[model samples]
Target chain A: MTYLIEGRDGPWELVVGLEVHAQVISQSKLFSGASASYGGEPNTHVSLVDAGFPGMLPVINRECVAQAVRTGLGLKARVNLESRFDRKNYFYADLPTGYQISQFTHPIIGEGAIEIELADGSTRMIGITRLHLEQDAGKSMHDQDPARSFIDLNRAGVALMEIVSEPDIRTPEEAGAYLRKLRMILRYLGTCDGNMEEGSMRADVNVSVRKAGEPFRTRCEIKNVNSIRYVMQAIEVEAVRQVEIWEGGGSVDQETRLFDPARSETRSLRSKEDAHDYRYFPDPDLLPLVIEEAWVQDLAAHLPELPDAKCQRFQDEYGIPRYDAGVLVAEQATADFYETVARGRDPRLAANWVIGDFFAALNRTGRTIQDSPISADALGGMLDLITDGTINGKIAKDVFEEMLESGESAAEIVERKGLRQVTDTGAIDAAVQAVLDKNPDKLAEYRSGKDKLFGFFVGQVMKAMAGKGNPALVNEALKKVL
Target chain B: MSLDPATVRRIARLARIGIDESDLPALQRELNGILGWIEQLNEVDIDNVEPMVGTGHAALRMREDVVTDGDAREAVLSNAPDTAGPYYTVPKVVE
Candidate 1:
């Protein structure tokens, strides 16, 4: 399905590109040896190099470089053996150095693509233009004081990988899907945490609009959108704004804008005259970064199975459907948990239980897979009870609920509640006969071609047996009786 | 390779260096002289020479990712013109 904006002249198409800045996961800053952890005391993580004191030089962090390489490999990008750092000069309160040390002319990674799956199960390959390494500026808090803004340099000098995408996204949903898939890949690679709420990952969105079969129009960049949902919303409102301008006999001026999520609109951040002249030149303080081919191969060899491969393997190995595999492999911990539960039990049953009641329980109680109330072994144990005829499916739900509340194993809950399934044929027959005796009219109707009444008799038998009767046995006994 | 008055003023503005309008002619002449000197390199007939990045042929040396510095907040903020509590403060810049 095509996503188009209904303009007065014709349908207008949207073109979107995203530049995502992901903070590299390392113990120290990219240049200085200061701690790069989030939420430190103000100015506590600032080093002389980070503070930009005169005559202080920067040395690269080996782990940070390896992390960038790991991320580049994860994206299936070409790792440039030789890359240089350049100084992008600008003035801002949060930036201690007048220029940001970024890769301008030669980026580290180039020409990669990520596959984004939309809501309709259709996938599209979004082209990655490049990924470069740069230093993050400190944060400024304007509301902290009446006359001044507070600056925190803890995040300054931290390494960030700016992943730029080609303008291939046609819809707002594709933008969201692209961000989600990129975050998933980053998290899977352990190069970045991909936490938007904590400011670990941020995006700059580029949006433009054009009539069908027309050339690309001027694109306005929306800067520093912190959340994935807001990215999607910004693209939508910005594209609509551009379409209206073009339809109103006006041209959209290219500029940097900010997404005001509260108003659900985008406003220009700077005018054309105030446009950025970054004056990029090679930094004299740092040398060119060169890596060996062997190092790249080593990093690529040790990467964990990525999400797509893991999702495919889950379907092939467990015989689960693609949808179930997708849900299970969204997170590494969840995939591991599913594998644990499906190790020896019936995999389809395991997937159904995990995706159904178990996930619902987690959501209802507000717990993650890492801190799930019931362990994988415990869930597997509950499935074991059902498979062995020790408990029926309905009884398992009760046991599951009890286990969630008390943090007990399924077997313990079953034993304490005495909710084992009554699998004996005689006992099931007696319960079925009692239910039929009590409901002769329904039975007469069932005999008179009202086959739907059979379900009511089964429900009555299970209720009489306290939801402990084996479901298959109840159905068989009901058929035998009537 | 020569600097015009407007280009000179723009450069000065971009660099945040305040200059008088009267200094444009002299500044433009000095900048053009410097550019003219650097432009002599274009006269050479070296078409296929690879660009030299740095003085040495060595790759950049990297440090271990360990926190060996920091924790002296007072020293870090010592040179700031103004500070509020433990933070460095500047005139409120919202954008």
Candidate 2:
């Protein structure tokens, strides 16, 4: 394994714990009925509750609670039956309330484990320390004006799920894997959309590198990693810097830092803020969230199969390879589409088409799986045409493009364009004979063990027939002639 | 956790609060009092009790190896201080 702490000596080890702030997947803000949509008119999504006005009290959104519970269930963490929001006292221009309402002593979820797949195809489980519900502070826009800092209250009181992890990660790969897994889980749970660029899912990485078997050192918290790639980059860069500092006989200070994505470097922000300094005490006005075991069970019952389970089942049930299963089940929408398209069809074929051509089309058109021009049924219809030999794979592509452009089915496209596979043996032999008669030199190459040129012959025959000839029959007749 | 004068000053600076020098003794006493109250957790044996991670049910989310919205270069860099086409610019960060 590469030295996790790059600049250090004396068998140093990286102890990485992540504090991931995921914006809860909800229609509105945490305490108010304001829209939580991103990139809306600046500060337009603010209510009195978000502004921290004198009379406004926090009214917890039940839908946000449901989303949090759903996320916890997905993580296999312990959902506290009684969790309460606490006031995290602080002073900032962005924090209009001068305090953030967050879960402190009584958090909603407890210990859980995340199975992260390594680059080697093996897996490791990272322990989830806690996941807390908190309201997000608004963004402090310093660049909005030359001489002033603007507060975008649109993010104020937005629900945030802070998923804290134990320092179980030992390598940068593991840390990266853990973060990606967490983001994937949040996205699947629909608790968070995991849009790191929009500041929806950010990470505060707690990194320290100590000698192997040594107790963890005072770790620095690198904050506001806005993208998964940036998070991993920050981890690698910071860990190496800490290790180098330690090796040079300097002490690692426990402070918060910021990652500059453009420069790919980490810089100190401020001293780390511990819980005690925040003066955390239960919010006096809001009552404790008294959830029952029955409620939790009901939520669990409604929980969809999470990533790991779905990946395994897809592998076993559909005979898809682990990599394909893992990919297919990464997103709930994509996985569902794969399942729908794979049903009663060749699983590998469905996966290839979905993950390959379908994905390319989606990307080219700037569409998501949810908002594709071709539905799962239409995709399945296209696959059926290929499987039943009604159209060759190449012909299916032409039909697929037609379907995308005209919003028609494979049958319609094949009929309209005369692109159906030519399965008639007599027609296929005639086309093959014509190609052979024209390409005696290539035929000689084929007879003399240059079998590769046989594909050229097949192509020539197809081109002569306007690509309407059945490829399988041509291959059969060509082999008989050889 | 008693807030001495120096500690009081540090906390004030950390919280970004301006405090009079003469008020140091009083602020220290109040902060110490608060820390002491919060220290009540020391009495309870949380030795093996894992810190709370999240609320609700426990499971992990994952996604397939697919890229979504990779072509948002212009839409993304639009919020930068200065941009040279697709990149965000700052005072040359590297000396």
Candidate 3:
């Protein structure tokens, strides 16, 4: 079903596309030899070229270019061999140069698609328009002074991959899923860190709403939405704003706007500036970028397994359900941890424990897969105890809790706590007899066809054995005694 | 395209260049003259020609990614016209 906002006229569908600026993972700036690392002293990363000193020139960084190609390949996009850098002329205090060097006419990557799986288990492909390389501007700290602002040139000229998407999204959930999938692919490729909080990845959302089956309308660009949650909220509020305007006999203006998450409203930043305003011209200081076809092939050959392929393989190899595989492969670290625990073990049981108890523990402790108290080897050790019948499933949960608390192996916790499974038939039969003696009235009612009391008898028997009896053996002994 | 005096003023304002109102006519004339020269290039009828973006060699020269040119804060701020502590201060920006 399509998401729609009801207006005076009728239902209006939202059309959203995102342009994500991902900082390329490179050691140096795009054209200058300055440091590109985040959070350094304000002016410590500056160089003559980045600061736009007189007679300074730009030299392209090979690693940044390689990273762009790597990202393009990861997105399943077509990479153009020859791409040009153009000067986007603008004036700002943070822009030391009067222009920004970016790809305008010939972008590096062409059309691609990303498959996004929604919460309802339905999937859709969002088209990627293009991916181009550009330089980032410096920061203007207005809060640093009461009467004056301060300039921080730390991020000047850092390489950025601007991934533009086609306006194919009809719902906010689809938009969120697209951003998440794109971020995952970028992280998997190691081309970007995808840290929105650190400003490593940010999105400019283009949103419009129209009556169903109508042509595209004037879309407003929501600038610098740093989080997926904010992007979804911005789309909702902006689409509703457009619907109201259209229904109230007004036209939605084409312009740039800012999403104030605190207020949950989008305010116009600037009226529409056409492409001619930028006056983009080819940069004279640098030549056209060209890469070898063989080099692209080589990079593709060495690419790591992506999330989609890993998810499918997990299902096929581990015999787990699609949902379980998806949960496991959402993050590379989680997938690696799961694989280590599932190797040569009962995969279904491992999946259940990891997805159920392990995930809950991580959430409760505010820990990530990297810092989980239980290691993969330790979890696998606990699973081995269950597989070898040393401990029943009920006792295994207790041992797991003990392992989490004491940072000890599952076997050591079981031994220290004496929680091993009582697999001896004689012991299980004795526990069953004791339960029957204590609950004679209920046992008689159960024997007279009170089938619902069967579960109660099992619980009583297990309690009498201190939850150490193997459940399967206790069930068998109870049937024999009855 | 011919630009009027008002358009010239708007362009100058967008560029953050403070220009006197009296200079608008002259600025408009100068900009139109430059645009006229660029318009002359449209006379060519080479429909099959590929647009050229670079001269000499078409391939860009790439350098290895390294951080060998930073931590010279004194030298970097030496050329600034105004400074406060480690930052370059400017007139307050409201936005």
- Considering every candidate listed, which one attains the maximal DockQ? 1
Q: After superposition, how far is residue A363 of candidate 3 from its true place, in Å?
A: 0.7
**On residues B1-95, what C-alpha lDDT tens digit does candidate 3 reach at each position?**
89988788888877878999888888888999999999998898979989776578879989999987978888888999998888888888754
What's candidate 3's DockQ score? Answer: 0.76
Give the per-residue lDDT digits (tens) of candidate 1, residues B1-95: 77789999989988779999999999999999999999998899888988777787567888999998889899899999999988999998876
Question: Native contacts retained per candidate?
Answer: 0.85, 0.02, 0.90
Ranking by DockQ: 1, 3, 2
TM-score leader? 1
Clash pairs for candidate 1: none
Q: By the DockQ metric, which is better: model 2 or model 3?
A: 3
Docking class of 2: incorrect
- Candidate 2: tens digits of C-alpha lDDT, residues A14-72: 78888899898777777777777676666566766676657776667777777888888
Q: Model 3, stretches more than 4 Å misplaced?
A: A271-276, B37-47
Model 2 residue A473 distance off true place after TM-score fit, in angstroms: 2.5
Q: Candidate 1, after superposition: displacement of residue A461 in Å?
A: 0.6
TM-score for each model: 0.98, 0.81, 0.97
> lDDT tens digits, residues A76-173, model 1?
89999989899999988889989899999999998999998988998899999999999999989999889899999998999999999999999999
